[model samples]
Target: MGRLLSKEDVLAYAIASTALSTGGGGVGPSLESVAKMYDDAIAKGARPELIELSEVPDDAIVTSVVATGGGVSPEMMMRWGGRGGRLRRDLPFGRFDPEYIRDKILENDATWCPLNSWSKIPGPDFRRKAWERLKELIGGKEIFSRLFFEISPFVTRDLCYMSLEGMKAIDATCAGYRAAPEISQSGLNLADVKCTPAVITTVWGDLLILEEVLCFQRAEEIVEGIATYSGGVAGGPFALTGKEAKKGMIPGCISFTIDIGKAILKARESGDDIAEAIVDASKGRAFKLFEGKIAEYWQEPKYSFIWGMVKIKGTGKYAGHRFKAWYKNEFHISWLDDKPYVTSPDGINVIDPKTGWGLANFWPAEWEPGREVVVIGVKNDERWETPRGLKLFGPQHFFFDIEHVPIDKIYKNFE
Candidate 1:
């Protein structure tokens, strides 16, 4: 029999899950959203059960719902909103705006000669037509491709919003699944019983689609497919975020997220320091790396992820020391005084030093300058540190050529 999920348990799971979602850096679902899910479940006499993946039969089917994508700048959102939130397709030259093209050249330091003429084109509409005419005159097929690349930020922001919607849809679908007669009839035994097994996840903003549901001979195969297909740890694997993926499946991941959230709330109520409380509650699996104010930050939409960096000036006992963190959707690497301190597969988080509230990757706009924060690092499952896991989520996977180092080794001096 599975453990019945109480209202409090649901809230706890959400809090922890949210922490896990951003690698403990940002907020996940609001408390109200979590509460609503629990309330609805209770009302429908649908009790969510918590069970270990090992307990399930080998023949069961399972699926994972993982979040992807990264933060979008407010500037991009406003720019698209002003254009009615629809991507402009009427391109004589393409979607490249004059200012956008100029910025691209400047960003690249004018290595490309053709972009230098961008400023000569007057007005957005005129610039598009002029670029088109120039491309035709020069017989440059690559010109349009370059133009699209320059304007990709806008398209990325639009996709970010769409991906967010997909996350919500998954959540709703999971709720529906839990309340269905099949789940109840199966006595909440996800495995052994014949019913669809779905694992809904929360993480960065990225979109994934399953053209059709495919069956597997074993449940573990399904878990592996989801983790690999979704890009594994860096891509959105549960193990990379501290949730266990066994035989490729995570049994109590949803409940686990809620449990972490509850622990945070309990610690806060007890008047304990939030970071310390989280560490203690996790049995020392989570720890604070540094506490300070954000000194510098930068982010841009790249490909399908938000590439960014954050700099922090340490405060209190750690004052005078500087720290830096680089992120792709989630924090992937951190440096202390220019030395690699922690890398991906290990959770990196920025939280309120006082309240322990996790800060989102895209929150620099509203976070203000010099806002106090504490950087937290939580150890991930050993499985994530393996050869195959590293390939999918290691520093090299994120475009960094550095070798993978365990968090414990990097922070050994601190201990």
Candidate 2:
């Protein structure tokens, strides 16, 4: 049994996806446009089903932003093993490489520089060109999956609804943190899109001529509104603005010392009088004086000159770990008071589970990474009540991953 989709509904989805992707997609905003088309179709009274993956039309188009090592082939494996006359290619009895896995990908491109999506698109029509170029870059499908396996055993495993296809250059840093990870191919599948080995293909398996994931059957409505497209990766004005623009983009800079000094330092410290200090510091910065809600107390958390020199004079026993000494930034500084916890993969995120997205260009993590990411176009971002206590990837919670890159990779800096 399936729920029927209407043209109006599809149009709504398009509104949502495009809104979410306001910045860009590799294929000339095609995905967003497609989403809009679906919405339009729904408006026309046509129905799209939120069906199980098992029910996917065999002939439909299926592609994954996720990719496996391309060099690997059935012939090479047979030559190497010399036995196992018949085997299932889809079911790998061993490890797999996922973009999440870094070490293995290095074998293919010594300089397999990492990359992510920017609010704006960087390369050519990326969505379409992935498999062809990646296959050439590595070797081909089979061997490439093998290369990926060396990097990620995680991807090989059958996770809950979706599977991970490892991507990275040999010894890529996704194991913990890596520089710009390119999107060879990626995307999540409906958990049961196609269980049959013949129907569903893994990155490690051969690239089939045609395929599609099972339908999505989740919430009918998105709580978050469509995010407006800003621009490609670095499309934002002064993204990662060296020492100059860090303050305006993020919150809690050194200015907090005088403005919101107490709240910033009270974290993991003498929790006393810190709140009072925050109030005292706010003299002229804010248009209106706030008691505990002093806006000036917060900085963007990047390493700014004002913040570097700013130090918190300890009161009674709390002396060390002073605000001046905090090396990370204002974002990381938040973990001092509130740490994050990694939730299950089912958690909500900026990228839709069904559509899948990559790192935006110009985003902090794109260049040096280990940069704090702030999701600009979150749906329902300004709600008076946030969904849950899950603050790691929550719209309001912006910062680095536990791996210390950004929120996408980890739940919290403290977690």
Candidate 3:
């Protein structure tokens, strides 16, 4: 028998999924987008069934789905304000309200503003005034056009939706299978599965959707692509046999994230200590590495990943210590007082000290200088520690000229 997925289950799965993405060294998608996907799926009467991998046949086909894309930082968006092209900020009302311009572009009615009217505007100044008028009529608020482009791609969310769509397609076809004389009377168990005829997992912002009946065994390659394309910010492959894949791929990762999210929400509702609750929910998997204000943060888009470093000056118990984290899409390496602290494969997450919310890897705008944060490290799957796994996802693979030291070894002094 399969466990029936409820709304709470879906919520838990979404939250845990995000954590798996971030904790596994990938830049996670927005919590809002992921939650919305699960909510929509549940509303449509889609039931996600969780089954152990051992229950699946060795030949059963499985596919992976993940989100892929880096987000534009606020600074980048602001810099592109005056530039022309898709990100141009000098267009009419472009400076005042980007959303208004977006609505106009999306509008289908020709009578409102003919396409030629845009060309008729005499000059830049005239066009500006025209946009201003339109903004006034639409009650637009002041917002930069570049800011409108800051919405990061939620590939994981799309992957989930795509999986649901694929299932629906399979159901339409499988109805004929049920009528076949040779087919079992028990019918196919589709409702209890997240992915039809297989399993599904994700990394931050990237998903690989494949057909169930298809003998696509390129998951290892897909995982490699995620790491290489992200410049070593994401997690490496959990390449295993079908049974091992079911048992070892971040066991209960979805449920774990959901539990953490739920615990935080419940704590916030009851005016309890959210940070404490998060620590409790993680069951010793998560711990505060440093508490400090961000002193410096520098990031640039390199090879499709947000490559950067963040320096924080410790406050309170960790005062007088300086911490530095180098990241590629996700926070991969960290130093405490010039000694190696947390390294890749082990999850390094930044939590807002005030809100106890974990920050996403791509949203540098959210990690403003002077903002207080608690750097937390969650243990990576033991599979990531093996020789082959380390070679694929360790510090060396990330081009760091250092050995793969465990977080416990580095943080033993602090503990």
TM of each candidate vs. truth: 0.58, 0.23, 0.59
Query: Order the candidates by lDDT, highest first — what do you get?
Result: 3, 1, 2
Clashes of each: 15, 94, 15
lDDT agreement with native, every candidate: 0.46, 0.22, 0.46
Q: Tell me which of candidates 2 and 3 scores higher on TM-score.
A: 3
Model 2 RMSD in Å is: 21.8
lDDT of 1 by residue, 303-353 (tens): 234567889998886788889998765677888998888887677777775
State, as a TM-score between 0 and 1, how close model 2 is to the true structure. Answer: 0.23
User: What C-alpha lDDT, on a 0 to 100 scale, does residue 95 get in candidate 1?
Assistant: 27
Global Cα lDDT for candidate 1? 0.46
Best by TM-score: 3
Order the numbered candidates by TM-score, best leading: 3, 1, 2
Model 3 spans > 4 angstroms off: 13-20, 23-39, 65-68, 71-244, 412-415
Against the true structure, candidate 1 reaches a TM-score of 0.58
lDDT by residue (1-415, candidate 3, tens digit) is 2354555655444443433344222334445655666778767755555443344444433322221334334443332221222322112332224453333333413434344433431222332333343334334533211000011123234324433443210101111100110001001211112222222222212223223422122332343344433322222111112332343233344345557768766776788866567768988766668888989987776333467788999988888999998876666778889888788667676777555455655445666789988777766655557675565556876788878776655664343
Question: Over the stretch 1-415, how does candidate 2's per-residue lDDT look in tens digits?
Answer: 3344333333322222221221122111233444454555445543333332333333333222222111122333322111121122122322232331233223322444333343222222232233454344333332211111111112211111111232111111111111101121111111112211111122222123222223211110010000001000110000011121111111211112112322323321554432233223434221110111111121221111112111222222332222221111111222212343222111111221112221222122221212211221111111112233113222233333432222233322210
